[model samples]
Target: MWLKNLNTIFVVGYPIFVSIIWITGGLFSSFYRHRQSRKLLTADEEPFVSILIPAHNESDTLVAAVKSLAGLQYQHYEVVLIDDCSTDNTWELMETLAKQWAGQLAIHNLHLPINQGKASALNQGAKIAKGDYLVVIDADSLLQPDAVTQLMTTLLENPNYGAVTGKPIVRNRSTLLGRLQLLEYVAVIDLIKKAQAYLTGSITTVSGVIVAFRREALNEVGGWNPAVMTEDIDITWRMYRNKWQAAYEPRAVCWILVPERLRGLLKQRQRWSRGGLEVLITNRRGLYLNPWGQRGLLLESIVSNCWAILTAISLVAYAFQLFFLHNLSLDGNLLILMFTLNAIQFTIGFIASQEIAQLTLPELLLVPVYILYYWLINLVSCIAAISSYFVDPQRRGTWRSPDRGL
Candidate 1:
């Protein structure tokens, strides 16, 4: 009876396909990014750039974020900080910075009557921007002095490149949770970003931490959709569809403060996962029209991620069924052996190969814990997707809070 049902469940429940999708998709991306990173423009061509930062109740960290930009190696730049009607001192803080910099920094403060989202603030900033290039940055994020120079240099040196994503180093790596997030950050943003850069011309979300776009591209794409929860992702898809190319020049570095606690990290990840589902769904037209979209984006995205969620969920459900409900039966030894072999294969074949240098023996020893975290994050992503299903334009405060630096 069990072997009979195994056929049905194996077809539905076997998560091997999920691993294959991620691995192959990841390999393509990683290979492409490797080549791109190897080839870069050595010549220096700095274009005047406009930095658009949206702030909301960021008084605690806004000044540092703004001041950090002043140190940029690329001197031709303007800093426009939008105070998106914060009840906090973020506005007053920006006022002080504006006064201190005076003529040295081209600073403009647009205080919204009420709280609007980051997209709206960015649209307003882009309207009055006085530069050939525009960069969207988060308040809590700080660009390295050379980050803008490298990113803008990529655009100036290569006219074909549409946008560039800067390398983001975790700022809060003090606590164990922070350290764990830091590792996760490397795995996701650093490693995965490299893959996207290589494969499919669609590097979906450039970190709000630091992403630069050509003025023409941003204007052509029409600023950002105030209604789009993840305007960053929306713009990327539009850019790709319009035939513009995006690049990942890791030389562009930005420091960002990750959540110190697991719960805070969960909220941020949940927001991103939910927001990403919105992006993938919203751009279904572009994905479907192109044949590669089926294998590359739509089918791969929906099927692969859905299975990842199901795998994590099923593992727990089976445990409950076997222990409490006594509704499922299996060879515990074979099952344990099966997972142990798969775990070893996955870590050594992939995780170790990619993160070996950074993930020490002790860190590698923590793979089991990391897997739990990974599953939790994926489950949260599914929840976020479910949430997006119910709320199209989910109203969660202003879309992009003022850069008071959260």
Candidate 2:
């Protein structure tokens, strides 16, 4: 009876609980906006914003990225381009772009002598930035015309908002892996971010692709940490502990290229997993002694980690039980029920993303298969990341672009 009850909780009850959170959080994210006017602030009225684009071996995509920035409708902003010792001709391309958009766009170009990773590059950019707010954009991403303007408006409206991160929709879906990633982004990443925002008034991470931060809030937290695999996650936690708020703006859209092969995808996921584990370890103390309304987020993180471990153990136990009972069945009632609930979860995610990203019908159709694919990959990645965190003390927190699909 106890085993049956545990199976029900894991298979049905937990998913229902998760779905409720997702639905309400999605609604809040979709409709909840500041009471201020919807209009984008004009140049004379708004605060100056520094747009930082950090590049490394991005010659192939630099031109398009700069061109997208050039088309921005925001007036009071400057582009600070940091070339992080690219071996390719990225510097030359950046120089050309700087000259071409010289007067039309205020461009500051800096070249590092050696590749110091993204965190160091961003820190360098922040130090010299003149704007009250700093906007970080990856060189490989293309921001919408009003992306910067929207982010700034959102940040300025709330005095406590330390940072605001934009939505990153995958742009490269030419390959099968890419298509799978598209579904994962909309169904998993986006949903969780919205839910986190709604539940805690904070998010787990400010996406590295495109995020804006108030200069003072960043300075208070000592800028960005260089030792973590993900600077974004590290900074978010710092802001939280420092009593600053982080927000997610779904309307602020940035298109990003995703890895389109299995190897590249796995590497990206592993890097994310390692970064999360690093944050968990670093913040272990804070999780125990919560301060200044930080207990909710702290408890959430601890629970999430515990849940992952328990889920893994439960699956192994269930497998052994089935084998011992000689009652293994693929077409069981529990399997069908679980599948239906997952399908409902996917549909809710698809509809939410469609409302935000304008996704097409065909992309929505792929959610069922993509859900299973991503679950297995994510589980394996989490296990690998946990092992690395404990056993591999020599691992360097570095950044390298994943393989671009053919």
Candidate 3:
């Protein structure tokens, strides 16, 4: 009876409880944002921003990214493109763009002799960057004209903020996988960030693809950690440990490509999951000693990992009951309640994100599929990440160009 009760609470009760928190917090955040006026900076108030693009074998997508940067509405900014010893023509492409936009924009190119990871390249870029504020974007990302302006304004307005992360809108929706990711980004990823910020005054992690960091904060936190699987998650927690706040700015938008294939998507998710797990392991001391508000974020991460493990175990138990004992104890009502909660969560997220995301009716119809995909992918990735961590605990943070959707 005790075992059954434990299973029921973890499998059904915990998810419902967390979902409600996310939905309530997300709704409140949406309304709050709607009421607030847009904050814009005057010419004198604008700060110089150094935009860093770290590329490793990103020749295929680098040009378009640089071109998009050229059109940024923010005036006092320079572009620093770092090629991390790519085997492809990424270096040559960077040089060409530097010359092409030489007179028009303050474009600078840096090339590494050996292949270092993204974090190392970023550290190098920061050493030579002239701006007081640094914005990092992936080589495959296309920044909206007002993205830098929005990120900088939010960071500047928040006197205690160490870093600010923007929303990443999926631009590749041509395939079923891509469309699923699009909904996941809007309904799950973006909503969770807003909810986390609303509830705890700090976020779990920043979207490294398009985040702006204050130079002082970066210096205090020792910049990015190349040893971790995900530098973004590690840095966010480090800043929090050192008494710096991290914020989420939904208005700052960046169009990005997602993997359109299952293999690529799984790889990406596994890397993300591994990075998160690594941070949790490395920062476990903070759970007990950290006096800041970030303890909530750490507790949430622990709950999530426990939930994944329990969910996997429950699935296995259910299969055994069905096959060997010819007994299935699944509760129909509990399943219905879970589904209803998920539907409500997605509805709230869609409403909050529709304006910026331009969500369509057809995409709305994919909620059911998206829900199943979300659970399954997260389960598999979480399990795989755990296995990988135990197998190779000292894995270096190296990356390859991800599958850009066709």
Candidate 4:
């Protein structure tokens, strides 16, 4: 009886509880941000921003990315294009662009002899960056005209904020998979960040696709850790440990491509999952010592990972019970409650993100599938990440161009 009750709580109650928290927190954050967006914010001073693009064989996307930066409304910025030892013509393209934009915009082209990784590339760029604020964007990213301005406004307003991450909007939605990912980005990723920032006052991780960092904060944290798989996640935690706040600015939007195919999506999720696990493992001591500080960000990470493991086990046990034991006791009401809560959360998310995401009516049809999609992906990736972490813990954090959707 005790075991059954525990199972029930894990299977039903836990998800409901988490859903409620996210819903309330997300709604509160959304409304607050909506109100804040109405106010006019003027920066007292224009700080020089170094836009860093770390590329490894990203020749196809680099030109478009640089072109996007050239249209930014913000002034006092330079582009630092770091070619991480690309075998292709990425270097040549960078040189050509550098010469073309020489008079218009300050373009610095740095090339690495050997492929160290994204983190290494960023560190190298930072050393040569002339800006007080550093904005890091992926090679495939297309920044909005005012993205840097918005990020800078938020960072400058909050003197304690060390970093601010922008929202990533999926640009390629031609395929069904891409559309589904677009929904995920709006409903799950963006919603969760809003809730996290509202509830905890600090986000778990900054979106690496588009994020701004203060030079002083980066210096204090000792820059990006080259050993970690996800430098973004690691740097956020490091800032937290060093008493620096991190923020999520939804207005600072960046258009990025998502993996359209299942294989590509799996590979991407696996890398993300593994990087998360790596961060947790590396910062176990700090988390242990300061479990409740920073609103228990590290503690929440540990809980979320454990929940994923238990969820996988629960599914297997349910299968075994139904097939072998022939005594599957499913709670219909509980399932309904879970579904309803998830629907409510997604609805709130959609409404909050509608302005920025420009969500369509057709995309709304995939809400049910979207919910189930994330659950399956999360479970599979978590299990794979755990396995990979134990098997190849010493794997170098390198870079590879991911599947840019059609």
User: Per-residue alpha-carbon lDDT of model 2 for 117-198, expressed as tens digits?
Assistant: 8999999987777898899988878998889888988898899999999989888888878888877777777877888887
Candidate 4 per-residue lDDT over residues 86-155, each given as its tens digit: 9899999999999988888899999999898999999999999999899999999999988998899899
So what's the TM-score on candidate 3? 0.97
Give me the candidate number with maximum TM-score: 3
Positional deviation of 215 in candidate 4, in angstroms? 0.6
Best by lDDT: 3
**Backbone clashes, candidate 4:** 0
Winner on lDDT between 1 and 2 is 2
Once fitted onto the true fold, the runs of candidate 4 whose alpha carbons sit more than 4 angstroms away are 37-44, 291-295
Cα miss at 140, model 3 (Å)?
Answer: 1.2
Between candidates 2 and 4, the lDDT winner:
4
| Global Cα lDDT for candidate 3 | 0.88
How well does model 1 score by local distance difference test?
0.66
Give one digit per residue, the lDDT tens place, for model 3 in 1-406: 8888778777777768888888888889988988998867766788899999999989888989989998888888999999998988999999999999998788888999877698999999999899989999999899998998889999988889999999999988888899989888888898889999998888889998999999999999998888988889989989988888899999899999999889998988899999999988888998887755578888888888888888999899889999999998877787788888988988887887787888887777898898899889998998889989999999998767668885
After superposition on all CA atoms, what RMSD does each candidate show versus the true structure?
Answer: 4.5, 2.8, 1.3, 1.9
Which window of ten consecutive residues has the lowest lDDT sum in model 4? 36-45
Off by over 4 Å in 1: 1-44, 291-295, 312-316, 325-365, 391-406
**Estimated TM-score for each candidate:** 0.81, 0.90, 0.97, 0.95
Name the lDDT value of residue 257 in candidate 4. Answer: 88
- Give lDDT tens digits, candidate 1, residues 15-45: 3443343445556665654576443333254
